[model samples]
Target: MALSWALASGAQSVTSGHRTLFVTLSIVVTLVTLGITLWSRHSTHTTGQFYTGGREFFAMQNGLALSGDFMSAASVLGITGSMSLYGFDGFLYAIGFLVGWVVFLLLIAEPMRNTGRFTLADTLSLRLRERPIRTAAAVANLTTVIFYLLAQMVGAGALVAVLLGSSGGGTKDVVILILGALMIVYVVLGGMKGITWVAITKTVLLLVVAAIATVLLLDQFGWNLSHLLGTAASKSPQGKAFLSPGLEYGKTVASRVDFVSQAMALGFGLAGLPHCLMRVYTVPTARTARKSVGWAIGMMGGFYLMTLVLGFGAAALVGPATIKASDPTGNTALILLAQAVGGRPGSLGSTVMLGIFACVAFISILAVVASLTLAASSSLAHDLYAAVIRKGKATELEELWAARYASIGIGAVAVLLSLLAQKMNVAFLVSLAIAMAGSSLVPTMLFALFWRRFTTKGAVWATYGGLIVSVTLVLFSPVVSGSPDAMFPGVDFQWFPLGNPGIVSIPLGFLFGWIGTLLSDERPDPAKFAEQEVRALTGAGAY
Candidate 1:
């Protein structure tokens, strides 16, 4: 289909044969994915089936799905593009992302599965009497999902504009609307079952594409990664930038510290993300959750290592000029590199590369948006509406309907926000989301899971304090403030460097929670504490 479109649009004859082939491949992948998703829709019924795969998924299946959830456009395309452009600085992001999974595996996965019925809020409010705590957690969850959806929307617009050969603002808006609608369908109709299967399929395809691209590049360069790296180092003033720490390239000491600290913040922040944590509940057992996380960490780690090769390969083969020309948006490094490696339009290799990447991009966005919708819906339906508003009196069917409605509302709101924040960089927006998750929610979650002394008041204060500090810092950060050159020229004030405040905000979360607990007279409930500990450690109550 992509090929036909490319041919019909004159892309085949006008551009290199490689370009046409690429488009053709992309169309085929999209059609296949759409067909599968549609065929699977009839099987998805009830909220359990939609949200947690009926809690029947095996460890391996859930693990792949988890990888799918983790491998957003930010990981697949963004990381590749970053490495292609920034060299080692880009790989730093990948390392942080992958290593963060270790923290998730060790501390979050099994416990989250054991304690939460369906969402983060369920686990959080299990031992607490405070409606305020649940509401605050929901707020944090919503914020993270919205920011994440915005980044994915931006990425979708960029992908559509590149693939369709349209570069107008209207084109981006249309793409965002279409992507948003697709996500709603995936979540509302297909539910968790649909999301999980789609995610697994996308992960397999991503790994295959990475393998093929890596092998081809290595073969082209006599299978020498070191030689390729040396060439890239020789060509760019950012010599050996791919091998050393990102701080080495910082223009000043402050910039260096900011860069390294941001990387560290990002690494730790992954453990706190709502979408990532929600997946833990999909598996049947806490043990299964732990194993799934282990698998995800390994799989993701391998993928990140592959990205280093792709990035250096792009630097070596595509040249900076072409990358700059084709990737003005800075998100098309992999696409441009594929074009360079596959040769001009009409080539078999070029066609395949283009098709694979296009498919990967589409699937990446689909899986993530679906997860975001699910996260938002869970918070609203399970946490806010069912648990609090109705005091658990709502029937299962009512909860399901509420979730579907929430999905639509969340999708609409996200689309609107994406439109409003259209000018923001995708990476920066993603970082902000991670920072928010890390700051506001991670401390409370960790304390609730491991510390028997953690109180409801403490959790509430920690969540709000983290939210306030992180949001304020991010809003006034370089990305939003237009540092060095304000959003409106001449404005100056560097509230935070590197645009992500997780490093600062996460510690503040801990401090606030501690202080709040100390000031409150309330003590941990003995009965609730024992119940939660048993559930978290023994996989007794996950169902």
Candidate 2:
């Protein structure tokens, strides 16, 4: 088994002292997070508090939680690893992610908060008769949530395997199960209030760790980023290591295209993410939502800028061979680089830095999983069970209980899927999730917000069409085909050079939405449509 060998290799790379420290930190964070969840359950009893924190969260508080919701292990570790391995090309991802918030602030933030209550489905179906539109929106939301959750859970397993110094499938599976149980508790007990608090704390911690690492790394080279870039450029062939264009610095043309497309997908997809949009509802007014987006942009921009230093520092000191050796598990690049910079794993400085980095990673996972659980639970309880099955007759207590049960069920399914995909590279999984969000959810959400001509039929057709196209392309993409035989045997077709399908699929989503609207027989009442637009733009009816 290649998976067993890979896990064994990871085990051999970690020192006993490092392993002990990592496990202890993980257990402690897990316990504290759980304790908070249980405490919050007693305090939050209504569906309003469970889903949107009773609309009482401050703009700054929700902004910090938005930061946590957006920055996952993929951004924290994967982006740092990419920058370290690919030079300036890696920072491109950081730029794309931060710039995406500008789009959110200008186009989607206030409108989304004013239009929806618990989920995006609630907004899209507000003007329609409800059943048909709600069902379609729920389907789209659930598809994106499941795909994203699977990627996060798989990343968690890989991170645990690396930290614990174990290469066993059994070990990785155990980690997934443990994480799933913890995440279920986080959602069912803590609800929105607890999730928001944890996310805010985690975001602050992540920003501090990244800032400290960047400063220390730059200090190591005498605070000269240009000098470091010049040296790396000279060593790399074609002298394009620091340049923004072309496929120099050891990356192929295909890899370059992959990076660009992946960035676009991640950037645009942020606006469409159900969990991120849901956070806006926690704030009281449309003006507060606008302010929260502004805060998120500033925080995200600062974090991305720091990532450049860490990536370049790793490239300058850690070497390419080391990154290649750990390509299967990119999340470890930052950890390994930390060890390299601080002397050895057992050194006093190295241990402290490693512990800090590991805690940041753990919190990143916890925050992301909490968001995913909320998104999935909202779809199941609010959209499907309450709106469809019960015809909107369920009591508030019944709705709350249904959401809690849904959280557990969703968490369980995610754990199983993650264990099955444990041996695959997490970067590919993350890109796939981004592609799905961009293709299926982004176009529909944007059209709904900005276009008055968008019809119920248009929304339904576009959402389903985008979902089908993205999921199919991802399943047959090069990344999935090249996965270990254990995961997919004898499948050898490659339809796209870049594993992420957003480059083509995103355009197709827009096309479908446009065409579906054009062909629809029904039109919304002009008076009601105008009123909805005014409220969305001005936040007049959000309360």
Candidate 3:
């Protein structure tokens, strides 16, 4: 009876029955994914296939995969958890994320698809000198990918540990390692084809589960949205504050500025992310890429809308105290909500619901980590190794093998770092990753795509300089020290006031690009700009 009550309040650990079911479903999904990988070997033999899924996917398939890649543990779990605890402030994330996609659809997607060969570096190198620009872009790609990967790994390991009721430090490490190895297998063996299938499959499952849970939640409130919000506000300890913006970040001028900076990062950073940009290259043509982005925005917008309900549902049903008790970050709110809605603990319905959520969460982690690993490995092989190191002389076979090895290496490093970083907050890392991307990649991409006078020196300076400033600021920021959410709580050396560096670093990136170009003696190359514009607009020589 206590277990049954705990389900409604989300105050206790998962039941043993649910854990068993969760483990079983996890195994089934893992085996199925591995089978898909094996089957994909036929298409992955060529470099184009391995890197871009042979550029064969149509608009809808690529759109679903794009949605899958964008909707990570952070988007589903982190944002919902924020909503459950912070209410109106949390919905700001949904708005910011959606706005970022508008940037991609209007500016980045079509041209990126038309110009790039395999990676983001390929596009940057089109107008600039090959070696320096490629190397700089590769560094920017790896920095963003590794940070994003570490956050995902930590969240996955923690979520799996909670589902299985395992608390030992070694068990957490082992979970991270296995998850890393599983993702590496998806990238190394299956490449883009296998990864795309997994993304599309998992994203649909995640959306379905969310939709079902939302419907059940609506049923409890007589299908009235206002009633749900009212119940959530009454149940929350913050009361009316839970329905307003001040609960999370509106307390002081400084806090508001930091919030704005974070919002900027979320709004502009999606266009700059290497993994998201790489998705554009998978479509058959520029027109298909634009259509795919439109589809992805629709799906993602619907999902975020559903999260508002799920967030309120968790607040009204499970309460914030229990959510924090399960995980301080409130990432387990949806899992608890799933069990509560299904039935009382130990019931057949509860067991089935718990099993479904376990599989969903596992697949969410797998899809995101696989994309990140692929992105990082592509930078190493296609950009750094083949272009910079081998002077564009390496054979396709050689580059492909290099990519596989790079995936394993990157996974291993991420697993170890994630294990060490278990105490850090996943949400903070996600925001940091976005801010880094906005600071480094956004400026360079805009200048290269639109400005004729943008030189190699300017591009390199923006990439490397923006990266250094962002990383250095993060190292000294409050997220790393001096507060309750600090990664190293005992340390107090925080100097940067803002939690995110986008507001400051992004402008610096653009300024560095402009200043570098002005100082460089390299003559303006209008012809190169014309050629790139022609290719980007007309889709010539894209394949």
Candidate 4:
């Protein structure tokens, strides 16, 4: 909600020791990142290496990297806070996020690996008119990437401020700048290889930290899962309602609709996240790609399960009123929980645990931003500059250089936007990002892979129509101007009711694809479609 937040109730103050430990741990993390980047930078000597990690990563390696990309600090804070605040309904995000991988594994992973080289646009260009398809996909890619980048950057700033126990205004801005600069350095120097290693490392650290916290929390409740829930129900303001569905989304018809919209966004949107999907290309084979997704699913699934303990644990330990007072979004809940479970609030044990979470959170933000920046720059360089601007005449070296330069440009834009929108609803922006990803990419990519009748016009319409409608709807929706938490609280132009546009825009993506294909005079080529089908299914003639 607001950028200005006090420490959580239990954490009335951060000890000097705690702040020093956090700074030290953070410095160690930064150095580790640079070390990885330096090594990876040396490894990246070709266009293939820069864009796809030279396709040498094993299944588990790429999978953990993929997990690193998907699990942002914003997501961890938001989901855990939601779990603490809304109980069961908040767990829906974890469910939706994990289930999206099923769609990816079944429908996208193998095909994407077989068809794409560096970006999704490459897969579409095989059958569609290369220019329009690539341009539309690139635009959608950049738009989605920017939103995700902003969400992560803003969350990073806020979380950093919270960890340091500083007032947000200037402190948050400074963190955003520093994070942006580090992200630029990571992508410009290390590229995909560097980003992959960073993500792998981040994921491991997150799992370890989360596991330790869960064990400590369970021990606090005598290792009884049922006891924890009972205690959480006892402590929450809503009492027993905290364990039920209606507490959050079932309260009203509009709220119910928002629930469905949210489910759609998390499920399909995560599946279609451009950056996440492109990681499949980094693995060596389609089988490895599929296995990597399986690995990602398992890893994230375990992590989501852990959120249950942390979330309800916090609710049981740190009261909702205290959490809301500190930060309305429930972010302070996690830090407060860290403090509470580690030991007495403000004590050495509690603050040390809090400091550790801060370190992992900082790395989580860095890992995600680097990956998104890589995807954004790769789309701009490979799809737009080399393919569109130079008409495929650009050499490998020129394209590689273009990607590095594009990373800086993209990082600059993200930093500037994050600073401008720091006070806006970061959660709302994140939802819109996921919704737009689903609407813009899901239908287009699915049709290109499965539907024999799919054409360039269909791809173009699906990408542009879904992208425009979802964004336009959100612009007029409560997120932008009507409700108390709206981006512009002083305005009241909201006409749309749903907070997430996924339910409406997602189906429209498919409908627009069908409509555009029928409207186009250009006939689908059977030979090319045959080629694509064989290549997609059997991995024949794949790059």
Best by TM-score: 4
In angstroms, how far off is 500's CA in candidate 1? 1.8
Winner of 1 and 4 under TM-score: 4
TM-score of 1: 0.92
Please give, for residues 1-543, the per-residue lDDT of candidate 3 as tens digits: 000001112324578888889889888988988899889878898779989999999999999999999888677777787788889787888888889999999999988888898988888888798999998998899989988888888877777776777665676788898999899999989999999999998889989988998888899889999998998899888888888878878988888998888778888788888889889989899999999999999999999999999998989888888787776667777787787778886788877887787778788889989999999999999999988899989999999999999999999999889989887766567777887898889999989999999999999899888888888888888878998777778889999988888888888989999999898888867888999999999999887
What is the C-alpha local distance difference test score of candidate 3? 0.85
Kindly list the per-residue Cα lDDT of model 1 for residues 91-186, writing each as its tens digit. 777777776888888888888888887887788788876477778888889988887888888777766565666656787798789888888888
For model 3, where is the 10-residue window of minimal lDDT? Answer: 1-10
Ranking by TM-score: 4, 3, 2, 1
**Where does model 3 exceed 4 Å of error?**
1-11
Residues 199-306 of candidate 4 have per-residue lDDT tens digits of 999999999999999999999989999999988898888999888887888989999998899888888998788779889999889999999999999999999899
Worst 10 residues of 2 by lDDT: 1-10
Cα lDDT tens digits, model 2, 26-142, are 778777777777877876798889998888878888889899998887787877776665666666677777767888898888888898888888778766548877888788778
**What does the lDDT read for residue 72 in candidate 1?**
76
lDDT at residue 286 of model 3 (Cα atoms):
96
